[model samples]
Target: MNISISSDPQTIAENCADVIWAEDKTSRMLGITRDSVGPGTAAVSMIVGDEMVNGLDMAHGGLMFTLADVAFALACNTRNSIAVGNFCSVQFLRPASRGDRLTATAKESLLDGRNGIYDVTITDQSGRRIVEFRGHSKIVPGTHLAAASGDPAAAEV
Candidate 1:
């Protein structure tokens, strides 16, 4: 999906998210859908399928983490800068079973220069929190998309 976005940060951010959703094959394979993306925030959702269940019939912890991670990645990248995950931790609060639709919401907690901190909460459709995640991001020197296109916006950051 080709998207033409203006040089503004918010537009760049939204375009970056579009690129992620279009290019990230792993996210596609997991059936993750981006519900929303804005500056410093993102929400993503996925349904627990039989393939995601463990022997105990509960959703695997890794899949839950991945859901939260995707939200975190989208939130942090919204600055129009290329931000990569430096560290992340997750705590499982409840077990999710097959057919449960899980949503992960990420919010930026802090941003200091090139470093940023984000918190993500994963919840079931009923709004019960299932997992908590914290992610640290490091902003790199280039924009994810504009840099590739030789746009001046990439150099502004």
Candidate 2:
């Protein structure tokens, strides 16, 4: 969990996204991409691949969940604190198929002390809702990045 973060909020958010993409091999293999990251929001996308299809000839639930989870992780970690998901629930509305590009957008709904709630919406390229995910997170005591070299002010986000 030793990652390089930035003092700037936006840079910290971007660094979190980069760290996620670097650390999560499952997300990388699934073709997940971090589209954007902000203070309390993140967007991730992936194209449904043939290998990701399930027995039903549709995108597997696990893949969709991973995409949403990545977005949730990026959104929650923007504060430069190590945020771990405590609970999450996903509701599948429509099945996705190979060649479909899916996007998951996560927005923080509430944050109190170390606890937070995020809502993620997964949609197809056409903007059709595919899944809904709600994630609960808890911020831990450590910072994601160490202080930058020669810059005392670049401590944490």
Candidate 3:
């Protein structure tokens, strides 16, 4: 993919996230915000809405999973490479109600070649644990800046 890549670690991560965020319609639609991004780390926040509630009046499992997945995606792709989730598992701890603000923080656990593992923990505004998630990622054949204005150049890690 032809695109200009940043050299600075924080700038690269933020730039990569900018490219992703511009195309992440699902996250925008769900009111998810990219709270912070850095090399191998990301934090995304969202609020539980009535639409995301389950029959029991608690936040649906899928909603929380989506939040974690957003953070996981940002973390894995910060290295200037396009990455996709290979597998993921989430454990719901405390149920959240509508109006609760949750933040999912993803941190790199292990990185070996094109494969990586990330751990994501979701917490409510009060710092109560809500979910624990693990994601495996596989680097793909592209760069996050592929859609940016530029000719194709290799985005180095």
The CA lDDT of each predicted structure is: 0.90, 0.88, 0.90
Candidate 2, 69-90: lDDT as tens digits: 9899989998778899999999
Error at 88, model 2, angstroms:
0.6
Which has the better lDDT: candidate 1, or candidate 3? 3
TM-scores of all candidate predictions against the true structure:
0.90, 0.89, 0.91
Cα lDDT tens digits, model 1, 1-157, are 5555476767777888987777788889999999999889999999999999999999999999999999999999987677999999999999999999999999999999999999999999999999999999999886656454666655566
Using TM-score, rank the candidates from best to worst: 3, 1, 2
- The better-scoring model by TM-score among 2 and 3 is 3
Identify the candidate with maximal lDDT: 3
Better of 1 and 2 by TM-score: 1
Reference-based TM-score, model 1 = 0.90
Give the C-alpha lDDT of model 2.
0.88
Regions of model 1 farther than 4 Å from truth: 1-7, 147-154
Residue range 20-58, candidate 3, lDDT tens digits: 888899999999999999999999999998899999999
Task: List CA RMSD, all candidates.
Answer: 2.3, 2.2, 2.9
Q: Residue 82 of model 3: what lDDT?
A: 83
Clashes by residue pair, model 2: none
